[model samples]
Target: MITRFEELDWQDTPIGELTLRRRTEPAVGQEIYEVRLGDEYLMSSLFTVAEEELSTLGLAAATGDDLSVLVGGLGLGYTAVTALHDDRVTSLTVVDRLGAVIGWHQRLLLPVSAELVEDPRTSLVEDDFFALVRAAPAEGEGDYSAILLDVDHSPRHQLDPTHADLYTVDGLRSLDRHLATGGVFALWSDDPPDEDFLETMRAVFDGVVAHVIDFANAVTGGTSSNTVYVARSRTAGEPASDRPSKAGS
Candidate 1:
């Protein structure tokens, strides 16, 4: 059999060594793309159900005709590209801390890269998403209609320690400032539903819901799940009663 694995690109980043690899699975006889940061796997093309759902569920909560969306992570470009599928999205800003990640899309290193970069509404920005949220625009001055994040593994688990603050009540409050009055915020987590984090989100946002997305895991021949938290920014004069906590699957 011919060689099935190839390392497309590798770079040393501030956090660790970033590498992109492509391999053909013998069982399925299909090509799969994967990204790794040092020894930890960042993302894989083999599974992207929750990532797409992040855009779907987030935008579903947003009420507007023309939507300006911001995506926190650019892994494999699934989340960003999924948002682009919605014609209502007038603009999309994808922020990634690693420049190399953005470079991958620009170079069309992955399958979804062309679709994400070809769109005029798409803008790939290299910056710290957490920092941007912390220094969000003044209330009501914020322009984005929806903000979706999938940077870390989960709220309790983070790729970097600095990201821990963003999961807290105060950090979420700052994030609330970045959205328009009726804008929505969504996050993807590798872990199961986190009631504690949901409570923290409810403190700042109105109508907080945690959605558990289940998908088929080919490797394990079993079902795996990820959590997507959807919440709307509290508008001025909005009653406290409007905040409702719920979970979905």
Candidate 2:
């Protein structure tokens, strides 16, 4: 009988808990857990296809100079780092609710993500993404050229329940308000969303499109993949009725 090499027990590192376990021959990648929550898979570097897709969409939407962008969920900072690489982006705002995650990024993940956060155009906001989008400037404020969201595992599989509200009717409406004319909204999902979710996006925006990126293991270089959704705004030549109407006297 043949045996595969077994490594040390999973260690809960500061960045995120990492487990070294063996699975069937078909499943052969490191499993990562969220240390603070325990038993939740945050994500592994093994699958970064979605992250790259997000960067691609964000840059495309930012067609002009001095483009401003808002990215929700810092994660491993893959998407943010990619966004910062573009010179057209004048400002990059990153919002994440977990301080621990931020700490981990600063401590352990800095070597990989520091440039993205330390760049002159980067600003880190420790707050709830929902509140920030909902409470945006009332009117005449400059809207973001792109809003990239990766809060949940995907639209169908959310890591946190509170995030479900983000896809709701009111939630979509609020998201549309934050985009500049001709801005784009991009979402990263572990899997494809349901038909209704797609419909909701269409209702909120004039046009919507979905794109999927396949991934491969960097270690073994095998074929494995993930999906990402990119929804562009229909803001061209359209007046800003998306914002709330002022109260009548």
Candidate 3:
């Protein structure tokens, strides 16, 4: 049986500080927050289908036993928790730009995120994801097997305007430099990415594909779809592209 759920006043929660209004409910015994800023639905703490898709696709493309990964965002620790499920993953570094978000996980969401955060395989960092990727070792220069990014809504729709750089040709090229040989870069988006972004991935990596996931709200039974972009590093003997194209030009 489902327990009776309570909605905390939006003015009393951390989610309220980051978003305009917040409402929470229980789904399968887990708490899910539905936050809205103006008319836009930000994100939630439960039923993370895109995060699962990123983890599943990232692990499938990984090579070797001691696989290292970099997660670009730490939303509710869903992706991090999912990544920790694989025993082959030796190290996982999660980067988040907001300290308050991290603090929320520690104080309020610890019961849900504690296992992954305390696990020996996890390391959390507070920084901009773009800076982390840019400062990482050069392409074919590190041990990272996968770089999973969920920084923005999608290439076509961004939560923040600055995130548009992440889908640009230059941005993809910079991201390509941090990947180990045969390593994969997986990105989660709220909608299917535009063709330009797909072509940008093709220009930088040897293999590129898109995976679609349909998410159903456990409480409301409403459905929504998201996409994951998977790109593998060029093999030793393969040639990589260096050309830059205008976005959707």
> TM-scores of the models, in the given order?
0.96, 0.76, 0.80
| Model 3 score (lDDT) | 0.72
| Model 3 lDDT per residue over 1-249, tens place | 454444432333322345422334544565455544445566676657778878988788788898898998886677888888889999998888777557655655433467776788888888888865656565554557999998777887776666677678787777877878888998887776567788878877765777777778777778777888887888877786454322210
lDDT of 2 by residue, 1-249 (tens): 233444323455533554433222334434422222356656555456678678777577556887898899887678888888888888898898766556655654433456765688988777888777777556765388889988787776766666677787788778878888778788877765456677777667654656656666655667554555566676566743454222110
What is the Cα-based TM-score of model 2? 0.76
Q: Of the pair 2 and 3, which is ahead by TM-score? A: 3
Between candidates 1 and 3, which one is better according to TM-score?
Answer: 1
Score residue 148 of candidate 1 by CA lDDT: 97
- The 0-to-1 C-alpha lDDT of every candidate, in the order given, reads 0.91, 0.67, 0.72
Best by TM-score: 1
Best by lDDT: 1
List pairs with backbone clashes in candidate 3: 139-177
Model 1, range 18-113, lDDT digits (tens) per residue?
Answer: 999999966556899989998988888989999999999999888978999999999899999999998899999999999999999999999999
